[model samples]
Target: MIAQQAIGLIAISALASACAPELYKRDGIHPAHIQKRQHIPNVVEDTRGWTFDQSEEWNTQSPGWGACFAGTQQSPIDLQTSWGFAKSSPPVFNYPKALKGPLNNWDFGPQFTLAAVADDNTTEASIQFSHDGVEETAYFRSWHTHAPAEHTIDGYAPRAELHYVHYDDAGIPRAVVGFFVDQATAENPSSGSAFYKQLESLALPDIFNNQTIPEITLDLNLAISEVNDYKNFWTYKGSLTTPPCLEGLRWFVSKDIIYLSDAQLESLLKVSTFGARPVHRVWGHQVNA
Candidate 1:
């Protein structure tokens, strides 16, 4: 059955390329929007890089950027429950009671920077699991955010999304666990408010404006507990959503949504800009739950 589905998807994907190139422009994403990124302490981003709305054609900056469009396993694909089999095991989180600095990463959103110093070479937090019979461990690196979310589930797009980036013992990119963010309405309240408290603490725009860095801490352990029931996720092999989109990434997107109040949701949106890449093809990759 899986083989037959693979053949069918391949046939569909092949036919998709014959269509006209579809372009999705970035909304209100300009480098000057947040002037002088990484100019402050604990705020970090690639000092020299490209923007989502630079000159329109990103490929002009580098020929390698073509990979962003041409890759077979590019990410942020709309996921469906019927696409994958049961996962072999769930990934484990090893967050400390108190993880340090909300390092302002203008490039991939704010990261909960645990590495105290630039020269530090130690594992701060990690996630361990076995996939395809191979046991692997990835360490926590950054916490990223995107407006209007990224990947959709069964064609339903959420308000926003968050990414927990992890790496190997040597700081190599490993796996990412993503959760969709939903707004709290009078009819539907937030289930993860306890965890949203941490976000409330980080509701400051100074995190992005290169102003005085404030002391912030994260309680991810509490977050995991609140999301215990929603632990179910879909796993797949994909790539980064940004330019020069790299492949071979392990992706786990939560089946549940993280709800936030109007004020809290607005706080996040205040700092976020729309540079989210368009949803790409899933190709023949299998998604696991």
Candidate 2:
């Protein structure tokens, strides 16, 4: 059944390309095309040789950043304390009940959804879905933290926002996904790939300068197409990627790196400075490649 579903998805992707060349691409559906990426190593390596003149403290404090700086078991590094584990287990639901609407009917389970945006100058991305019937939203934004240090994700350039999961009325997470944008190539508007083109269509204009671009919404189908293979993700329990730094949460990040044009990335930086948080501690969590 899963095999059939995969085949069907591929067919649908092909059809989408014919229907909307600007929205979907023929090459965006392949698992091999979307390669896994390394954030920590990429930043530390600095193959681009970008300059970093800001003080360690200033850089760390820059607009958006955070991680497990206290050396907790957390994988990324700048988080605070561990909530330990929940003693009382969450409710469990039967298969029949699970299929119902608004996951709230179920006891506990993980759900997935896709989001994307694109237009003239910017591309915005996010995932919106209901978990346990509770609806929540997670979008990309520039994030940063102090403890660790100053660093940036290449291609993505300056920063990218990783909106932590949002909770439903029941206090359950509705979604968990990260947002990222990188420099687009001149040859291509963004990645010159079908996936990037899909997002460009929904691009939003800048607020300050109507002529300038701000951020645009990413197409859900295109975004999912970019990361179809889930095997290469890093999974762990941690806190929200934003302030208030809530702890005790599950995080799954794909090792796969998505690309955009440099010009597209520069447009985003114009509106927001840094968008990523520092690496938090691994917290004894096994990082599966």
Candidate 3:
């Protein structure tokens, strides 16, 4: 009986060894998804908060939907002439000191207010600006969705985009600048830059793109590359370029134009409607050469 029992036990042990489930091996853990855990830093979080009184008092009402637009003086004007060397004009800035209080108190820096305006006699469109500060500039070009127009400049090919400018009640001119870009290249001059890439990598909300969450990180450093050259530019004082257009802004436009590849221009047009906004008249503001 003892020998029989021993044999049975041995058989059971052999079966367990052959059929036992594989040891529960643990798999490597992955790093947390940065996008899932990232947060956008509001640079002007502590700036003076905007109240109903402030908005009403300054005549700077916020846009209800689409874009929270602002009304100002010296809105964007049309670019009718070809690119060429012109005489310089004296810089005339009489920015109101009191107006700085309200602007400086706001939370964000200049918000991008893009408008596509008619250029010259062609059906071309371009972007305009209303930025905070003495001067402002942006590279304008057709996104991947649009074709590039040939021009004397290396990177500037005419597409449909214009640049504009304006000023708030405080006497500070809202510098509207435009950048002409080509989208064909993989390198994104603005978002692709090292700094902007970092901010973009953060995957912040695209306020314009249905607040769609971005997949890539955002690099804030690209802002450092803003053009400072004001030698060649158009100068004038006009009204807010958009609806409810008010008057009284001092404008300065850069003479040097930026370029974008074909791909970039099309990408912009695809997102926004093919036509931005039409360029308004220069309105009697002195066009200083």
Candidate 4:
């Protein structure tokens, strides 16, 4: 009887281990509520309305939905000078001459998710940034777009904001380079941006296929270089603009705005959610560069 009980216990242990969900590390810390399921969740899978604004289904309202409300450091705040003091010197970006990847395009329910193919050779793509104060290098993970932008800059909301989410070696989100993009008027059409062009291409096709597409390449260097000035930006600490609203993020809102063609903006709007969480009411948390 003793031997039989021990055998049953061992079987149960093995079964539990087998059913355990995969764990991912970020910022050198792992929270039980946060897991990188599917690299990124396709969309708010629950009964929540499609966009981030669906507070009805959030952790705050639902209890344990995630950190959306329980946490104080929510993002999408207005990037104003009065909030935080300016930094004479800010973090510097060490971008590669070029980025290589067999990128995959996911038709994430609300917005498109363009991620690395997750293989030995395909994972080599990354960019680095460092500020004089912080000793660690922030590495690029993936980037995505939102129409009408999320975080506003000095009361001005651009047509779109490209969120370059990056992380450190320990899986901590280091910095997010928010490149604000304006729509080009007929007089000065900003058709030279390759990054937005690539995004448009991916989105346009998905409209027809309605499926995730994998095995594509994008020149990340060319896309980043489209911005005229990367140095003049704002810095702040905030939470992930999305659900779970994870805080402790380092944010950079670039003053150098880029231009996106009307056609490109149209395609993006067709694919992504209207925008993200509203600009929070909290103030006094911005640093000028």
In candidate 2, clashing pairs total 69
Ranked candidates, highest TM-score first: 1, 4, 2, 3
- What does candidate 2's lDDT look like per residue over 1-289, in tens digits? 9999998986544332211001111112233211211111101111111111221232254222233233233323332223232232221211111111110000001111122122211114333433334543444221211111222232222233322232332223323444333444453244443444533443323322212122222333343345443333444455543321334444554334345566544543444323234554345543321
Which prediction has the highest TM-score against the true structure?
1
lDDT of 1 by residue, 103-185 (tens): 45343344454554464324568888765668888877656677778898788788888777666654345677788888987
Candidate 3 residue runs with Cα over 4 Å from true position: 1-75, 80-157, 160-174, 180-209, 212-228, 281-283
How close is every model to the real structure, measured as TM-score?
Answer: 0.75, 0.40, 0.38, 0.68
Candidate 3 lDDT over residue span 72-169, tens digit each: 22334454445343354324322221110000100111122212233311112222333233343222211111122211132334453333233222
Clashes per candidate, residues 3 or more apart or on different chains: 0, 69, 60, 8
Q: lDDT value for candidate 3?
A: 0.30
- Give the range of the ten consecutive residues with the poorest summed lDDT in model 2: 101-110
Off by over 4 Å in 4: 1-50, 61-67, 81-90, 97-132, 186-189, 199-210, 283-286
Worst 10 residues of 4 by lDDT: 17-26
Candidate 4 per-residue lDDT over residues 1-289, each given as its tens digit: 9999998986544322211011111122223222322344222123222344564355654333365555555667777756553444444555554553323222221222334344321234444444545555666656666667778867778877777766655444556777777778776567646776665555343322333343345555554566654545667666676644556666777666677777766666666445545777554333442
Local accuracy by lDDT, each model:
0.61, 0.30, 0.30, 0.53
| Error in Å for residue 270 of model 3 | 3.2
Q: For candidate 1, give the lDDT of residue 97.
A: 79
As a whole number from 0 to 100, the lDDT of residue 242 in candidate 4 is 60
